[model samples]
Target: MSAKYGSGGWATVAIAQSVGATGALIAELGWGVTGPQRVPRLSAVDKSILYRQSVSSRATVVAFAVLPVSVITWLLCDFSRISAIVISLGSLCLAFSPAWFFIGDGKPGQLLAYESLPRLVFVGIAALLIHYDFPIGWYGGALIVGSVTALSLSAICSHLGFFHWKQNWRTIRSQKEVVLGRAISGSFTSFAPALVGLVNPLAVPVFAAVDRLMRMALAILAGIPNRLQSWLGAATGRDRHLRSLMSIRYNCYLGLVSGLIFGLLAPTFVTVLFAGQVSFGYELSALSGFLLFLICTSRGFGLAMVAAGRAKHITISVLCAAGVGVPLLCVLGLYFGAVGALAGQILAETVGIVIQSRILSMKWKSNRQWSTYAASVLQS
Candidate 1:
């Protein structure tokens, strides 16, 4: 009993350190070095804190390793020059190795099948059929595989304590409405790669990395305003002060930063990293265009909708827009080439953002007015 207690105590400490580190790194990447101060240290007995710590640490290690390498690969396009593939594989091995060892799994197939089977099969099919290697087809296949991988594995890994966190089997966070919003958010990651995936399956790798990292960044950036608005909306039920204000700020900020980066420096970055063999400006352009749209919707619009209990409307709107936007980008790309193709992407997204924002802003205003009145009556 004494020996077992000692081991678990040490495990908890290790996990706490990991989460603190993860929070620090993400804060650095998203908001820069000057963002928020380090979160409070974990108490050994605090499971949530411990779980957060491990998640943070594992995430930081993974992001720091993957982000730079993906950027380099995007710029250089040469597998030989970038060294990203080897590093990523190696890094995964290292990060997961400790946790993997801690998990005693005598039933290997059972664990793999239940936890990771669907996603593994998806990737296997894509690779074996050269679906990923094929142009156009690669995008769709990769999107299906990649999005599902992040969603499902993140789900599984959490359950198995693979990231050193407690299992949270789909709370309100994973509700149908929230899940719908997340899918819309994920499309920004998926759409650009799918758009150009037909040309080279390998490109999906860099694209997926960039998309995931950027979404992570946006989530961090918009987190504060979104949270504030969400709380207010729940307590008060219609406060645009939190939702609408934050939405525009987040959206415009994403578009501005990403656009500037892609337009000004993407080609140069690609050149240095790819060793000048492959180019990624067009790829970056497509990605930035779609992501910019997402930032606009996510930062402000989506938060407002959920707070007002209008997630169903938001989800439907996103689906309809995607239905129109994706096909349009494909058709445009077919006729006009990649640049022209992305222009259509930009157009579709702008239209979607505008429609959602306007409608949601109105809802927010009306709801807040009613909420303020109710609060006043209660106080009286």
Candidate 2:
């Protein structure tokens, strides 16, 4: 695509992706981080209710949110207006997806069938379309088709009574702090990358492509750590602390090995996959992979904080990173282009990991001290 349409097409896709990611973040609303904290503590019935409410609430917000974003994106990307609209539609479908229900239930099979399969179908269709020299917008349509199918299946599952729906606006309202906090944090987390694209609009494709590749590497390697963090969140007392430390250690080792492998393979991967149009970011990809490793290693502690209801601390940490990272990205991107953007992102993630680790360490030390003090008093 970059070869055919040049940087403009890639920029369009990148912008659409940014808009879509924002929608996903709005839908996520810390659920990815906080769901584990709540799921294990709730009864099965309560979990079902929570899932339905979450889906409904998020869907409602996304419907309203996506419209303005889509319009703004379409206006901004005059070169790819239809493509932007298609991407926004697909994003809206994703926002309303019920895959979270399966995730909360620990039904990986259903999640795969309902979430993964449709996406695979979309990929196949998109490949065929592109092979036949169809319009780029057709790719977006394929995504929407697949997403609609997945959503239809989710609706069927809900109709079959797999989930319980309860209208609890009061309860939903009560979680406003968490939902808004996570939304703000997530927005900032995404802002740096998007800002790079906006700043160096011509380099959008290169930056976005490299970021996507690095993210894929992180996704593949970080899965285990991600699940571990979930389990850590569900653990209690000494068990929680023990598991947290163990998870961090295990992921650090895993991340080192994975980062090494990714860094070694990334140059070759870019050469083959992007046919060298994006070779500029080959080294950046490797660097980003290592940074991703750091982020994944620290994730368990972050989850533990969320589990302990320390969302404010997490939010503050992210805000600080964004405040520093965004301007750095713009400055670097203006001067160094995509590589500078990548550098800025690494700086941001590093700051985030450092702050989060420090906060978690302090919390852990405080807890240990209190535990020892209580034990001494009991002994006396």
Candidate 3:
């Protein structure tokens, strides 16, 4: 897509992506962390009820959140407005997805079927369209078609007892804090990229392309560890402190190795993949790969924190990172364009991971102390 559309076309696509991502962030509302943490404690019956409530609540919130943004994007970018709206609407499927249920249940296959399959189909259709030279503007519509198909399949599966959903407003209300934390954290993360688009129009495509590719790569590498964390959290009859420590240690090791390997390879991959159209992407991809490693190392700790009821800490860390990072983004973008923006991202991630790691360490120590005290009391 970047190759065919050039920077201008990719810029439009980037705008659409930002809109969709923003909606997803709002829809997720911190459930990515909180759901996994809380779901295990509920009965199967209650899980179904919560799932339905969560989906409905998030979907409703996303609809309201996306509408104004769509309108604003429409007013601001005449050419890409329709595409942006279509893409953003398609992202609503993410809210309805049963991955959270599957993850909570320790069912990876179900998560893959409900979440990954539709995305794979979307990719196939997109590649076919792009190969045949379909109009670039229509590509966003393709995303909608794919997402709807995924939603329909998921719905069918849920009906057949492969997944669960049972509406309950009260349960949804009970999760208000998680929802708020998710929205705030997501907003801080999403704001930086959107700001990049506004500050440097030309850089949007380059930055977006690299970011997208790096994210795809990281998802593939990080999927297993991510699933494992949820499973470990939900596991019973085990030393949770030991599990948490082991998970963090191994995850960091894996992330460090993966980051280094990908960082070395990303430049070559970018050069070949985009046909040199996005030459600047090589450096950005390298930086992004390193950042991905840092993120990977922190993922276990972050999930552990959430499982320990530290979602607020995660949100605070993200906000602090954004506070420090956004100004740097604007300054770097103004002075050095895309490269500077990429540098700003790296800086921000570094700050975020440091803050997060510190908090996680504190939480771990607290958990250990409390565990020792409880053990002594039981013995006495």
Candidate 4:
């Protein structure tokens, strides 16, 4: 079945594929960032005390994943590419923008000067673009991808206890490492997309468009693992077993909590944002339920990646496989339509996650089963 927003079925596939490619490129940033100079400069708004103090991940989660919604809006709104470009930039700026807090030796409430000054400026530009309703699908992602680059470095910085993370020859190496790592993640991701498509072609695009925001929102926890590690390392950082257990605790609890929130809110949020009207179908509802389930699953998976080495090794693979699976799903859609396509995707993701989980068990220093994983986080 074809939706008329863009060019119908095939065009949807092309756009979806393009998004996949972009996601792959961005995944490299988080999977790879290694040093401080490599760290992206933050904008003024991002640096501001007000924004940092006021903004909560819970409140603004919908705003972050606006790419898919923006695309849908553009299709329906008939907004100019210029508008789209502006919107995308704004989102990208937001995605990249974060104010650094001392949280330590300095004022516990203070902003890191280095991070604040630049973050303020950049996000200022971004905020302007956002108010204008810029289209964010095309490059917004690329911008966020760059943020992950910093995230990568942040990982090493925290592990080494280098609060003053900066770029160096070593971090430069991170660029390549990030891409390579993301490729690994993309390949695994392909499994989910591929199988889903085999079951239901419609599922691929449906999720691609809908899941974009949700996925990004869930990924916010990329910072949490480090936070956990840092805390564990602290004097009273809590018990080693307890600290280690934070891995599962945050993954299962934070993720599932977010997933539950997303499952409930994402539907209405995307509906009004993308469709320009709020509506939901049973299929859409079930799909939405599944979508949140997947995101919740990612919580444990992301921590697993951090624990193992890099998420890209597993995540990139799953996404890339899903990308490949989409077209195959279309063929299946010719027969089974949406549900069948979704079935294909579900099976693929299930199988792939299982395989990846197995790999994680063998490869991981500590392994948490998925069921237990979700439960742990839920308790947290």
Q: Which candidate leads the pack in TM-score? A: 2
Which consecutive 10 residues in model 2 have the weakest lDDT in total?
Answer: 159-168
Candidate 3 wrong stretches, greater than 4 Å = 75-78, 130-133, 160-176, 236-238, 371-380
lDDT of 1 by residue, 144-190 (tens): 35433543454465353333334422222233453454355324223
lDDT of each: 0.42, 0.67, 0.66, 0.42
Quote model 3's TM-score. Answer: 0.87
Off by over 4 Å in 1: 1-174, 184-188, 198-240, 280-298, 368-380
Model 1 residue 239 distance off true place after TM-score fit, in angstroms:
7.0
What would the per-residue lDDT of candidate 3 be over residues 296-336, giving only the tens digit for each residue?
Answer: 77676776666555766776677776777678787897677
Please write out the lDDT profile of model 2 over residues 111-220, one tens digit for every residue: 67876788888868876776677667776777778766766676566442233335645545755666665565544344444576666677676777767776677766
The TM-score of predicted model 2 comes to 0.88
Tell me how far the alpha carbon of residue 217 in candidate 1 is from the true structure, in angstroms, after superposition.
7.7
Candidate number that wins on TM-score, 3 or 4: 3
Global lDDT of model 3: 0.66
Off by over 4 Å in 2: 97-100, 154-193
Listed per candidate, the RMSD to the true structure in angstroms reads: 16.2, 2.8, 3.1, 11.8
